[model samples]
Target: MLRHEFHPGKLVAGLSLLTVAVVYAGDAGGAWEAPWFVALPLVMAGLLLAGVAATIHGIRPRGAARPEGGPQGSGKLGD
Candidate 1:
């Protein structure tokens, strides 16, 4: 399996949605009362947070070192 970069944005989004689901589930199970519009702000906040995370991730630079013999480090034009 190929390893991939960790994405904070996705984590935030998932957690936000999970929170909304839990709220509704709790209400349905008679654990507590939840307003119908409760999820609106939560989802909006999640989207905003995810966008910020993604923007920061994209702006950040990767490792400075380049693998030996890789096309990127190779001096020759065109891989």
Candidate 2:
């Protein structure tokens, strides 16, 4: 098994999302608020952060590389 190095980008992205979540949670019931407002931002931020973290980790030296012609495989409609 290959061991991967810890990626600072991933850590930073995760921590940033966590910070955003905490901040939003704390101010969830302020005067300027609407249904799903807080939840939407939080979810979006979480997803963005997760994507950043995943990208960082996924590209690490020991991680799996994208298959030949890109993520969809062989660049073909039906492979």
Candidate 3:
């Protein structure tokens, strides 16, 4: 039962797909316009941004030692 950190990368990646789906559904319902070419790059950028962010986020404290865990049932990741 560890308290997790917020992950912006995952959020961006997920939102990208969600945006695509919504736009596609809207177009199908004659409520929006979206070309595949534009959509493709947008999706690519989203994924790329997500990856880059994730990499950067992961790089922080990248080669350093982690802190010691607290007592048991302290709601941490590892002990």
Candidate 4:
């Protein structure tokens, strides 16, 4: 099995940008009507959420610290 890691903030930002592109494309192609007020606010909200997520993620420590003051290498998969 393979593991994947991603920053929630970056994901949100990227999705927001993609959505903005979609809105613009749709409007340009006359596929649907996207009011500037709604689209702009949606983009803004996405950016704001991303920024908040990034700030929270930045302040936290990386991976879990090893168990404290117990036994060495006891937590390994193989005993």
Candidate 5:
């Protein structure tokens, strides 16, 4: 199972930027206006979602670290 400390600060920052871009885009009135207003939020949301997925995937426990001396299965030459 995977375990991760979920952090929302970065997501919030992205959302804030997205909001600003949306408002700026909204002020520019034209046929191309609404799509531009929406583009930033969509891109920001995708990036943040991908980051969250990566963090969750990375935290899964695999196994113990290797022993210090050498490989585990190799028998001594003259035991």
Candidate 6:
């Protein structure tokens, strides 16, 4: 196991993608109907939300306090 700074943008992006996958999976499994148009909007909205989240996180002022032993000054989104 490992610990690191939590990135909400990434989390939201992942969840959004997962939700889309589940919906299509359900359709494939014959559980329900999911039209092609549904996926287009879903993916676009997810990307928009992810971009907003990342922008928010980037603009947030860095506080004096941070979790001890965390990586510092990585300057990368995936860090």
Per-candidate TM-scores read: 0.74, 0.35, 0.64, 0.60, 0.38, 0.71
Q: Per-residue CA lDDT of candidate 5, range 1-79, in tens?
A: 9976555555655766776666666667442445444666666776777677667656665433344345654456653
Model 3: runs farther than 4 Å from truth? Answer: 62-79
lDDT of 2 at 23: 63
Report the Cα lDDT for residue 70, model 5.
Answer: 50
Off by over 4 Å in 6: 62-79
List pairs with backbone clashes in candidate 1.
none
Q: Output the worst ten-in-a-row residue range by lDDT, candidate 2.
A: 59-68
lDDT of 5: 0.60
Output the better candidate (2/6) by TM-score: 6
Best-to-worst order by lDDT is 1, 6, 4, 3, 2, 5
Specify the poorest-scoring 10-residue window by lDDT in model 4: 61-70
Candidate 2 per-residue C-alpha lDDT over 6-64 given as tens digits, one digit per residue, 9 for 90 to 100: 66666666676776666666667573434545566666776687677777666655325
Ranking by TM-score: 1, 6, 3, 4, 5, 2
Model 5: number of clashes?
A: 0
Off by over 4 Å in 2: 1-35, 62-79
Candidate 2 local accuracy as lDDT?
0.64
- Backbone clash count for every predicted candidate, in the order shown: 0, 0, 0, 0, 0, 0
- Alpha-carbon local distance difference test for all models: 0.85, 0.64, 0.79, 0.80, 0.60, 0.84
Best by lDDT: 1
CA-RMSD of model 4: 5.0
lDDT of each residue in 1-79, candidate 1, tens digit only:
9977788899889988999999999999999999999999999998899889887877755543344566565656685
